[model samples]
Target chain A: MSSLAVGCRLRVAVLVLALLGAGAVGGGSTAHAADDGELTLDSIVNNVIVGHAEDGNYLNFDPFATVELPRIMVARTADGALTVDLYGSTKGLLKDGTYGLVPHSEGEGGHEEVITESSALQEAFASKAHLHGDIVRTSGHVVADLSITRHLIFGLLAMGIVLAIFLVLAQRYKRGVGRTEAPHGVLQNMMEVMVVFIRDEVAKPNIQGEKWRTFLPYLLSAFFFILMANILGLVPYAGAATSNIAVTGVLAVMTFVIGLLYGSKDHYKHMFLGPPDAPWPIRVILVPIELIGTVMRHLALAIRLFANMMGGSLIIFSLIGLVFIMNVLFGEAMAFGTSIISIGFTVFILLLKLLVAFIQAYVFTILSALFIGISVEEHEHEEHADDAHAEAPTSQTSGALSDRLDAVDDAVDDVTEPAPA
Target chain B: MTEVIAQSLVQPDVGLIFWKTIAFLIFLFLLYRYGWGPITEAMESREEEIESSIQRAEEALAEAKEIQSENKKARREAEREAQRILREARESAEELREEEMAKTRDRIQQMQEQAQAEIEREKQAALQELRDEVADLAIEAASKVVRDDLDGERQRKLVNDFIDDLPKN
Candidate 1:
């Protein structure tokens, strides 16, 4: 574990360097370093948004933008709160006068106007503190009446492409070309390795026969999807879409649903009423606890992914902010050292982030498989154990009965032998 | 701003952005139809191709093995043929040697027979000469003994007895 951690640290260093390099280019080109006092998620997200902003020229009323649409604007207020402003005009009627803020999540008329002047406007904007956004949004008549957060969209697209590539490679392997020797095509070969790795390393150990294959698709897809999303988020300007609680929650729920549906009768019964093997008193006490544990596990999956992504982003954001803060204290002379240190640490963290991204994905998939395995395990093993135990007593009784019979027969033989020949 | 917020608050509805859903669906549909299907089919076909190729390769290998076996059989047969020819030649050579040996034996037997016959003829000739000599001697002796007595009749009687006792040549 120490060696692994060291290696992980090295990787993190390299990753940080690469991310910093990317950030440097991005920051140098399209972003401005925050003035001395600013260091927050809101600022970073805002920088990313500002970097990707257009002059609002590409605006169209089409829900799905006609042409390639730029990313939405992300900005921060003076107090480090995040704002997501949809600033483009479309062909629709302009509802222009400055409007006050309202909290949509809360009921409309029941409470006081939650949308206060700056305060309510802030609610519309997601808080940088809690990763909330005060989103200024608009709708248009497009192919799809939805314009998702650019980060989510990118993540989705990336997932789709990655999935497609994997599927294609899988197809090629099935065709049976270059199988006898080593795999021929690079992608095909790599994919074969990955598939085997997931199946053996993740699925087979946890999941048993027929059911393993049945659940393999969902598990593999989820793992790959999360991985793609994570990597995409790592890219500057690309959002780590999985960081969104809703997305992760959905994925966790899917795992939960699968665990519920395909699970064995025993698993279901045990989940609610404890395992049949448990003592009567224990069963009464443990069933509810077990049920809660199941819920908590799935909930943990969601939180783990969400927290890890958000955490990585925050670290990187804070480190980069270190550069500007140092510039304020020691001027340009100390700025370079601070930049180097920031970049150095960032590079390391970034690498760990990469590993974390993959590890998390693996964990999610493996856990999903484990749940599936528990649900689908054959009852025969337990039954066999019971049978063996039962057989011991039966054999003993049968042996005693046979011995007694043999003794009686011997006695009869002795009596008959004397009068025989 | 308050009006805008209030209005949004009043209409706090999150509609399933139909266009977005449609777009996503289309994307999904395309992927399902074009991407996944082709990929899966390609895999299946690739598998089939590989399987057939392996089968064909196995078949070819089997054919090669068969041909090799046939060649081996033919080679063995050819070796047997050479062995048979060699054996036949050896047998013929043996037969010729036997015949020559028999002829040489016969020739020797003939020569021995000739020598034996010559020896027998010489002995018979010699015996004849001896008999002649004996006869002359007997006659001379008889003439000398019966010189004064009836010598002619007695000598004639002796000759007749000798002639009766002697074998014809």
Candidate 2:
């Protein structure tokens, strides 16, 4: 208990230190805010540029502040060519109520504003920018750059490399390469156990016979891919690709497709048209329910992965925001107190994020397996009914009894039948 | 027209880029190919090896137990055989001692009987010799008395009595 309290205290202390450090860095730069006529966080977010008439009116080049996002320049479509206009307050805006162009317009004076704010500008900004002819206009802060995107790609690539290395080592261990017997390395041993566990505990139970192996590759692939992606996202500056709805949606769709392709007729017929085992009245209500359920299950898969990753990031962001808010309201001392709490929460969330990553991956893989299993499941009652029809003409009328008998027969058939060609 | 054209531009839908799909496909393929297969297989084989090793150890233990039991039985059997041999030897020695004691008793009984017979024979001979000597003395004394007086009559009387007594014996 004492240890826990101490840990909590330490976390709070760290948060406070981080908050103070940020405040110090920011404060030192803005020490002369009165003289500079800039002090607020909003001004920093907007950025500013200064110029002096002294020294032959030379430009004072200093960015007031840089935002986390980049400025987005959207081009408009028109016959003359595309042109982008900057709006709102930014570093490019001059003190004389004008905007600066990136490249001076053909000697239109240095630091000249290409587009000025006016009544027409307000109207233009209200409507979604149009793309017509050769000109189209749209602009926003470009939060990501090529480097950021590359970093994300690199994160994914690094995970792939790690997985590849593990595979190579595992394969070598399996083949007994470079050793007289199975390698005793920790990695080799761990891999061996996981392989066996997945085969027996996961694949064997949920998947049937020779067919199980056929689907094993996809299931395993999904598991590791999602798992690695989730873990990578937890790293600082690494974007959670899986957190993106589109990414999770694509994976869910893939699972759905596999379920469709590999699933036996019984899956669709039983789920959609009602299983033979169900009573007529029950089937009437259940078939639709089951069909809807199938859709919901896959949908849930998408939401689960997306929500888990996205939720973790949002929580961390909120915690960080809390520190800044505290600093603004209660000054440095109270900010430190709050910073500790926030940072501790952030750390806790980070740990949980790690666990959630693995769990979500497992859940996705297992659910996918379940779907595949369900799809291919043979309705014993149906098979038994068929057999009863063949063996005894009156056997189908017994309803419940016949259903049970048919189920037995179907199960037997499932076991006896060879893999379909 | 140029001023109007310069005023507007459209943002590119980078989010909707087809490159995402391409990247996703590449990632999935690479991950499938290199990552999951061997790890799973390795884990499985490791478990199999451990299970088999345990089974082998158990079998060896059972075999060892069997050998030990067999050894114990053999040792017991050998001990029992040795005891049986000792018992037989002891019984034989006892029988030999009994036989020797019985022979010694018989010999002593025979010697005692022979000695009694010898003593009885000697006593009978002595008695017979004494009676003969006494009879001779009495006859001589009777002859002297008859010569002095009616010695013939006395000697005749004594001889007659002796003859009667001899006839009775």
Candidate 3:
């Protein structure tokens, strides 16, 4: 018990130190709200929260170091032909002079792109003036702005890492490492444990037997992909791709589409016809409610993951931003004192954020599998019952909880493999 | 659109969604084909192999037990057969010994009876002879008393003729 407490304290101290260091590095160049001398609420909102979470062109490591990625877009040219424009970076696109940035005349969403005459596009950005809005080559008619942004790169990195890891693992198994022989070393063992856990624990109980195998690939992909993205978000400069609603929304949509595609005949019946014994008057109200509920649940599945991930970064930033707010309110001495509390809360939130990272990934995956599970579920009726009697109706994700017992039995008999009881 | 990037964090931007869709689909496809599919297949096959191996082991154990029991039964039968053969042989030997002793006793009794009959015949012959000899001696003594008068030859001849007619004894 004492050791556990010490371990917790040690983690908190490490988190506090790491966040303080990050804050110190990020303090000087928040960019947007530096208009005023002090760190204001506007700075916290514009620079700290938005800047960390936004899908921008430049990969902002710190204010000092930023890497600009390529911009790609498709636009309808004035000649009435579709053209794809590519740039080395946003700077290259502006330098090309075919496109220029104008604050959206609509006044809200930042910048819009319009054609320029010369190779030296918008003369203002020709040199450099806060030109961070993704400007693609367009005649004020950008059909598709597929610009490679910071979040995309990090998202790809997370995905690439997943691919790299799994490819190697797959190859190892292909060579009969985990297949014929015992999975050796930490990497293989750890991953096999994770894969098996996802299969038995996440996929099995939530989705019934045999059916789980059909969706196993999708479920495993979502689980590990989200997990990888979430973990990447915890890294100091790397942000979570799942924090973006667009990304999570796309993921959720994938689930929605899969459920729609593979949903059973019974599932459609349940969706269209709400309940068996309802009066038509009540059924009229309930049917819409049920439909909306199904749609909302999936949508919430997306938003929940986005919100949890985004909320963590937001809270962490806000917690640390309080230090500066306190500095201006009181004095330098009070600011130093506030730093202690700021660091404390930031440490706690950071740890919670770490936990939430894994949790949100799990929640998103399980919820997705559940939605698909239900959509494909054969409704057990008095007439046509489900044949899967081995797995119970309301079984929870506790099947893998007995792996230790199976492992013990496995030792007693090598042939009796470690399948959960 | 001053905060275009800013709003993208919350709003589902069409451009970002397009890219996200492309990226996620590719990621999902690649992962399923290379990683998820093969991994699950390998694990499932391994589990099946293990299950079959366990079944075979159980079958083998049961067969061995059956063979062991069968061997024990066969051994017991062989022992019983040997004991039966030994007892029969002993019983036959005792009967043969009893029969041989009875046959030997009957033979001995028959031989004794034959010998006794022969002995009686010999005794009768001897008595006849004695009688003849006595009669011949008296005749001889009377003849001697009458001064050898006796027709000795005639007396012998008559005794011989009388013996031949009386008994082919």
Maximum-lDDT candidate: 3
**lDDT measured at residue A289 in model 2 versus the true structure, 0 to 100:** 85
What ranges in model 3 sit over 4 Å off? A1-39, A78-81, A102-139, A380-421, B1-6, B55-169
Off by over 4 Å in 1: A1-147, A163-184, A381-421, B1-99, B112-169
Native A-B contact fraction in model 3: 0.62
Reference-based TM-score of each model: 0.56, 0.56, 0.66
Candidate 3, pairs of clashing residues? A97-A121, A104-B1, A109-B1, A109-B4, A110-B1, A110-B2, A110-B3, A111-B1
lDDT per residue, candidate 3, A1-421, as tens digits?
A: 1334323322322332244454443333333333455564344444655567777777876757767778787888877788888888876776676776643332333435554545434554433333444454445467887878767777888889999999988888899876777778999888888788888877887675579888888888888888888888878888888888888999899999999999988677756875544557887887888789778877987887787777677666656665764454444786788778877977876777766666666667767777787778764453334443433432222223224324433432342111100
Q: How well is each residue in A1-421 modelled by candidate 2, as lDDT tens digits?
A: 1334323322423333354455454334333431344233222211110001001011123234212211233433344444444432222222123232232121222343333344433433332111111111223233321111222353355456556756677467557542335566776666555545556666676665567777777776667667777787676545466665556777787888888888876566766767555568989998888778778878877776666665565556546665554554345797688888888977987887787776777767766776676566554454455743452422233234335434543543353232100
Compared with the true structure, what per-residue lDDT tens digits does model 1 show for residues A308-418? 665576567657765754454346887788798888977987787787777767767776776667666555444535844544543353245336435533543353231
Q: Give the TM-score of candidate 1.
A: 0.56
Q: Lowest summed lDDT over 10 consecutive residues: which window, candidate 3 chain B?
A: B1-10
DockQ of the candidate models in sequence: 0.10, 0.07, 0.24
Q: What share of the true interface contacts does each candidate keep?
A: 0.07, 0.15, 0.62
Model 1 Cα displacement at A325 (Å)?
2.0
> lDDT, candidate 2, residue A47?
18
Worst 10 residues of 3 chain A by lDDT: A412-421
